[model samples]
Target: MATEHPAKARAPHRRPFQVATGVLGDLMFTTGVLLALLVAYSLWWTDVTVARHTGVAAEHLRQRWSAAAPAAPPTGTADTAVPPRFEADDGIGFLHVPAMGVGYQVLIKIGTGEDTLAEGVAGAYTNPYSSAMPWEPQGNFALAAHRDGHGAKFHDLDVLKPGDPLVVETRDRWYVYRVDATLPKTSKHDTGVIAPVPTGSPYTVPGRYITLTTCTPVYTSLYRMAVWGSLVREQPVDPDRTPPPELRKEDPSNG
Candidate 1:
């Protein structure tokens, strides 16, 4: 009676195409996870590391300034107004934008190259005499920084409006600038934005101007954003290391 019992059912074999598709899906998922981790490191971890390094650097710079002798006042002439020419490695100065945020300051170094800006600091353009020091009487104090990552020193640049203070703190003086114009976007190759008399803005005459440049649209570097300002005044850094009146004002544009 059991002779006619059904044979054991066999398991269905998976097709080769199905096996290949499953493996491909798994590979794609792993790749996606790796990419996400990379992005997170770039956007988050870089900022953290740079901030820590830059803070220590900034403190060292201030200590150096304190140890140095006081600088003589500008003699009014352009030639005399030019302070001692300093190399980039000497820690040029500090940039403070009250409108950006409380305690919003970054070290000023001498090159706009990636290596310099990646240290979470602003870099002065050095295209063979394209930039000027804050102590220089009349030239573009052009600077560049990252807008989204690596401390994003100029990320809040778009919030600045006409009349906001852009202060540059040096060992002996505070070079104050007032925001006058902004170009929301421009070609990254446009050298004129950092020129002695920067083009593509309200500036047409040569003067003591400041240019703050950063990549536009936040996370991408497809283009550039420029902020133009005129040197409003200079205040001597007193013995007490007091900040200027502009920095003392409330941050009105930090919304």
Candidate 2:
């Protein structure tokens, strides 16, 4: 008689929990990938687009300046400087911050609106308080830009310290400001930071000051950061469009 063969062993069945855990892991991995892509798009892709827009804007400004006539005779007295008022669509000048980077520069537009700053340029505040132009004899020239993404124009603003140079380049003149104080964090509702005489700053009287404001803590808009500067001096832009020594000086922060 032929020997009976042992019954074939059955394969173990997988528990429902095991299958559920595997599915959960796969979903988590997919979600992680999507989140990373979102961050990259927000930070990298946006910067790339902004840079292109910024280049076009700068080139147009250069052409306009070249075709335009020199600045007209001063209409206001020395104590009350009155430069030309440009429309918000027309940029007023360029900002140079050596402390921020070796060749850190951004266009300066009139209004500090979302659309304005989204162009990867610096914007002058116009609401609640109008910003004083760099040519103004006395008042605060408040400005704003994105601290992260959208070109991150003022990403290194926190690096600026007392005596750091911040230069504004107009068609005919260069307005140089010196960092005197900083508010690392403050409520976003604090409009006083951009006032003619910014509160919480060293200034106790009216003066020609510059305030650079941006969102604080990076990647978040919960608070605001401000860097206050005083108009240290002014220099005439030569035919060659040479920058001031402040702009040329090497900044240790660049390292």
Candidate 3:
């Protein structure tokens, strides 16, 4: 009888669907993981980083102001006080919001550009209204800040309603503003909202206005949410005086 060899064993062949399914599953899993990581970094890591920067910026501002403090004049000399001229990146004032945040305060840096935003909280817009200050006579003091991350300074801005309190503190005085109106959705490039008299706002005559801008609808940058108000009260600062009644409390009643 002739010698016979066992037929050679053959490798199994995979169907096209089986191969495609495996590859697709791997791609989906990887995409999901990356998305989750991005969300964590936005909601958690950026806040932590920005908070530390804000603290350092705040201390620096206090030190600069203290060093520049003038000595008391001799009897018979006039007080002759002068207002401060803020430069780019300089901490000009503190933004205080009661309804949105009771004890929270953020530094208002000079320029609303990227560098100032990276430094602390909100910055004054550099276009039409940048030169306008809380102490100035008539113009809008436009401000911009992040809604979710990078200090998330204006995260709860949506909660503001008519009559809410908004105040800015400078070396000499406190400028108080009342929430007159809110525009929930506006085109990002609509610079009119930051105009001397915001285009769609109620004000007709030029006045001391405050316009606060932030990205709208939580995480998307598709539109802007604005809160506009007019200057209602201003009082010279005194060493012994405490903040206005609004700053010392919260909306426990809202709960």
Tell me the number of clashing residue pairs for each predicted model: 0, 0, 0
lDDT of each: 0.85, 0.88, 0.81
Q: lDDT-based ranking, best first?
A: 2, 1, 3
Per-residue lDDT of model 1, residues 1-255, tens digit only? 555434544556789999999999999999999998898788898899999999999999999988987766555522233466767655788999988988789999988888889999999989844687776657899999998789988889899988899999988788889999999999989988888988887887878999999998888899999999999888777788878877777555532
Q: Which has the higher lDDT value, candidate number 1 or candidate number 2?
A: 2
Pull out the clashing pairs in model 3: none
Candidate 2 lDDT at 144 equals 94
TM-score of each: 0.86, 0.87, 0.85
Residue 208, candidate 3: how far off, in angstroms? 0.7
lDDT winner among the candidates?
2
Q: Model 3 misses residue 47 by how many Å?
A: 0.8
- Candidate 3 per-residue lDDT, tens place, 173-215, comes to 6788998999999998999999998888888999999999998
Residue 150 in candidate 2, Cα distance off native in Å: 1.0
Clashing pairs in 1: none
lDDT of 2 by residue, 77-126 (tens): 23223467788757898999887877888999999888889999999999
